[model samples]
Structure formats: C-alpha cells, structure tokens
Target: MALLNFSQPLISDETIAAMADTMRTGWIASGPRVLEFEQALSDTFGGRPTRTLTSATGAMEVALLACDIGLGDEVITSTQSFFSTMNMIVKVGARPVFVDCDLISRAIDLNQVEAAITSRTKAIVPTHFPGALGDMDALYALAQRHGLRVIEDAALVQGSEWKGRPIGSFGDIATFSFHPNKNMTTIEGGAVVVQDEATARRIEVLRFHGIERLEDGTRDVVVASGKYNMSDVSAAIGLAQLRQLPAFLAQRRQLADRYFEKFPQIEGALLPPRGVAGQSWNMFCVLLPFASLGMTRQAFRAALRERGIATGLSYEPSHLSTLGRSLGYREQQFPNAERIGEQTVTIPLHCGMTIEDVDRVCDAIGEVIGSKKH
Candidate 1:
C-alpha cells in the first residue's frame, strides 16, 4: 500500500504553466502579477483592501504594525494556535494575553477573552482553527465594546465564512495563508485584508522596507521596515490556485464527511465538531485515546505508519513552549489547549484525497486504537 500522506497540495498543470510564464517575464519580483493577485484576493473578500506577503507570519506582523499596536499594549488571543500566532504578538513588541480554546471546536473561548481584557488591551487576534471559527458575533461585539482592534488569524480558513458573511469581508483585519498544506497554495505566501485603503497602504509600506515612492522617481524611507513582499512567481501560482479554491474546499468537505461516517467511535476518542457552518475544512483533526489505550501519540503514529498510513501532530500547546513559559504561562493555565495539544493528530484529508482514502485512514485508526485497547 502507498503511504497515505497526512496533507498534500493539489497543484495543477495550469499552476505550473503560470509559474513558467511568470519566470519567463524576467520580472519575478513583486510586479504586475502581484498586483493582479492582490486585486483578485480583494474581490474574494467582498472588495476589502488586500495585500500579499511572503508568509502569514508577516501578514499578522504587518496587521499589528498597521494598527499601531506596540510595546506595553496587550493583544488577547488563544493559546491553542500555532507558534507564529503568539510569536507575531511578541514580534510587534506587544504582550500576548493568552486564553484557552473551546474543548471541541478548538476556537478561543470568548468568555475568557472578555475576562482577560485590560486597559492596556489594544487588540484581539483570534485564529480560525483548521477552518472552524469561534463566535465572531460575540468576539467582534466584545472588541467593539472595549474599542480594541481585531486581527483575525484566518490562515487555515481561506474560504470559511461566518453567518453568511465571508471571514475577511466583515472582520477588521484578516490574514490568510497560502502555504502548501493550506486549502489553497501560493507556493509560499499569505495575504491580509484590511477594513480600509489607508490601512492597506500602511501594510504595503510596512511589507517592503517602508519606502514611499517619491514623485521625482526617487525613493524615501518614511519608516524603517523589512522586506516581506510576495514575488510575481508566487502571485502567478496563486492566481491559478485561487481559481480552484472553491472546488478544493468542496473536496475537503467531502473527505471530512467520509471521516465522520467511517471513523469508529472509540470510547475515549475525541472527534472534532461536525456539521459546522462555513468551515472550509482545511484539516480534519481528532484527539485519539492514546492515554486511555496505554499508548503514546508517538506509538499510535508508528502503528499507522506500519500500515502505510501517515499521521500528523497538528499542534502542541503554544503556551507550554519555552517562550510561553518565559511569559509566565504554566502547564495548567489553559487546560483545554493543553489537553488537545497533547492528544491531537491530523489525519489524511486534503484536496488530493478521495472518499476511499478517508476510509482507509479510518480503518487503520480503528485497528491501531482497537489493538492498543486489547
């Protein structure tokens, strides 16, 4: 049996051809293609101002910078997310006030978010975990009540929506990832959608060395910054990927449905929330009964590997990392994030997977868990 990869990008011939055409243009740096890609992204987000960068990490950093969040300011966010989520807060010279995630959806708990707000709280950075969103209604309401900025970390939820409104379309600031494993790929790029053109201009300046083009063809450094612009080569590939995103999301949903139907109900296994509205289903992760079955996650993965199946650890608790600890976070501070992080595994589910692939993975998991329980 072929090894069932946990996540795989479905790059088409059109994407390769577009990349070739871009390289042949002799202007592979940020150029027309980048502008076109940005425009297309803006349209996708209900004509919101959009900008592309090298990575979502840069996108979040730029969003924070554009909002003028800096030293001594507090940004409330979840502890369940990827390291970059917290790292970017620290990168922007702001304090990241961590909150625990919900037990099932893995979204940041809004009540804790509200409780953690302080006078210094300048922003709320909420991540849509693996395409599942938190309560946007309450989150934005809280932000509005407190007069805090909202920078949505929508990296895994490119096509996700909230109550019929698109994620980036209605949010204050939303950042999306186009990494290889995401719902769509720009090869290696990310985009940010802001509320207005002024902030968009600020992001553009911040992304590329803070240079403001002067009228006389001279360049002026308005503020010191770094290069994070997406190349035309990446933009060209992104254009192609964007065209297929709707279909890609549909495929992911179908695969996820198969997982829901086929995965056996082991007593202590914790599955992700099903039938979520507006979920793009970027990944289908589950918390297996590793501890209950007397098996470590490592051992469980190895068991699947023996069956020509691959598994992935979606995340470990970011708050338990060295950086988080240094920030005064202890082990039990965020119980839900800690528990999910320790036991979660991302199974095979992507645009490249079929229903049969989902079934194979489910069968293998059932075997692994069943054998361990015996």
Candidate 2:
C-alpha cells in the first residue's frame, strides 16, 4: 500500500545549493539574500515594493498595523478561509466583520461585503482562495467607496494573474506565504507587496522591532515591535524557488488538469471551482456531497484512507471556530461558508506527482464512492 501525502514542497538542487551558500556566509539573519529575494519578487510583480517577513501571518499583521487599523476599527473579510485571515484582524484590536463566500469561486462574496461596511470599517482583507483570484476590481472599488484600505491575503496565489496583471501588482497591499506546501516554498516565510515606498518602509520598520535607521547610521527605537524578519538562508531558498516558480506552476497545472479530467467520473464528489484563465492552481480540493451520498465527511475520508490515499480538509470556517464563537459569532451566520467547510477536502497535488498518480487517487476515490452507493 502506497501512502500518498496530500502536499509536498518542490525544492530543487539549485535551491538547496543556494541555502548552503547562505549557510557558509554566516550572515544568515536577514541579510543580502533577503533583500535579493524581495527584489526578485518585486521584479516578478512589475516592480511593486516588497518586503520579506517571517510568515504570511506576520506579514498580515504588519500590513494591518502599517495601515493604522486597530482598536475600534472594523475589517471586513470572508468566513471561508484559514483562521489567520480573521485572526490577524483580531490581533490588531479590530473587529472582523464576516461575509459569506461565493459558492463557485469560494472567494468572499462582494455583494455581501458592500452591505457589511460601516463608518467604523477601516480595511478589507480579502483572501485569494486556493488557486482562485477573488473579485479584486470590485473589492477595490468598494474599498474606495467606503474609504477603506485593502490588504489581500494572497497566501496561495503566488504567480497568479488577473486581467493580464499579476496579483501582487495592482493590489494596495498583497501578502504571500512561502510555507512548505504552498505554490512555492522557503521552508517557512512570507512577503508583502505594497504599491508605494512609504508603505513599504513602514512595513520594514514595523516588521523588525520598529527600528528606524536615521541618516549617519544612527538607529532609533520607534515603537518596540516584535522581531519578524526572514533569515537569509530561507530567502536564498525562496530566490531559487522564485526562479523555478514557472516550471512548478506548469507541473501543478498538468496534475490539476488530470484531476479535473478524472474526478468528474466519480459520483458524489464535486471538484472545486474551476480556475479562471491566468489564475494559479495551488491545491486541488474537492467537495464531497456527503448528504447526497449518505455519508459523513469523516466516513468519506476514512474510506479513502483505507486504500492508502490520504486526504486533507483545506479549512474549517473561521466563524465557527473557538475564537469565532468566543467573539459572538453564531452558527449558520455564514451558511455557504459553513457548508463548504464541512464538505471540502484536499487530495494529493504536488510538483512531484505524475499523471498516473492522479489516476491512482481518482480511481481510489471512485472505488470508495462506488462502494458507498452499494
């Protein structure tokens, strides 16, 4: 029985060698390599100002803080995403206003977002769902109408494009993750793309203990912020990953195409929303129509596991989590997101996988769903 892991990083020998070179330099802590990686990301995204950080979560926090979104402020975002999207808002002493997701794209419903805006609302953090780009044009329009800042949680959308422009290129502020399982990897790191130099400098100071370097090499301790800097070693790996991103994206697309072709044959399993043209395909997830199949999501997963095919639940609705409930969020508030959360499951999709691997996973899924029907 072969156990197929749900996700794996695509690291090449070049990436490994870059990290080794950084290790040999002994200037591994937020040095030249980090700046180089930021420059590379900037070049990739049409010269947007970028800053490398410890993690996407940290980047989100810095972005919010830089925007002056804090106590008594309200931030509007979707309920159908990882907790960090909402959690970052809460961490900044702002209230997270929830909006339901669009069923097809799994991105935040912009219609609901406009209605949620109030005078207290200071920002909108719209997450680009796995392999999908949300309606940024509409979101940005809404933000402009309401005088709200827009911070894109683009954790899963490295190299994704919209209307011929890359994701990080046009947004007010876009944060990306370089986690082990994301489209690209730096072991664990993140970056923020800002449209202006001032915002970029603000995030840089806020990310590294609020230290502002004055002219003549004098350092001023500004606000006593936490240390959230990326290591040169990680940035070196990220640079390599950035260089290889096109090939990685191609491989992921090939595997995803195979899954799209094969999964439609299996009954009671629904493929995730189709990626629009120019969208980056991150993780290929499927929604099991458990109610129609007369099985719980757990049972469906267990069945897949019995055949040595591992599966993953992409996310649980943030509004239904412990933190969500504690903050006065009730059940059924965001019905669509809750529904998607219950049924969504991530299967194997990685650069190392082959077309045959996709077939194996799909066949196993079909067998399990078929046995349930009988």
Clashes of each: 0, 0
lDDT of 2 by residue, 1-374 (tens): 77888888877889899999999997989989998999999999899999999899999999999999889999999888789988999998999998898765788888898889898989888888655677778888888888889999999888888898989998699999999989999998999999899999999899988999989898999676778899999999999998889999898888888888887465556676665688777888887788888888898888888888788887788988889888899888888788779888899998878899899988988887788879
Q: Candidate 1 versus the native: TM-score? A: 0.98
Which run of 10 residues does model 1 get worst, by summed lDDT?
126-135
Question: C-alpha displacement of 346 in model 1, angstroms?
Answer: 0.5
What's the TM-score of each model vs. the native? 0.98, 0.97
Clashing pairs in 1: none
Report, for every candidate in turn, its global Cα lDDT versus the true structure. Answer: 0.89, 0.87
Which residue ranges in model 1 land beyond 4 Å of their true spot? Answer: none
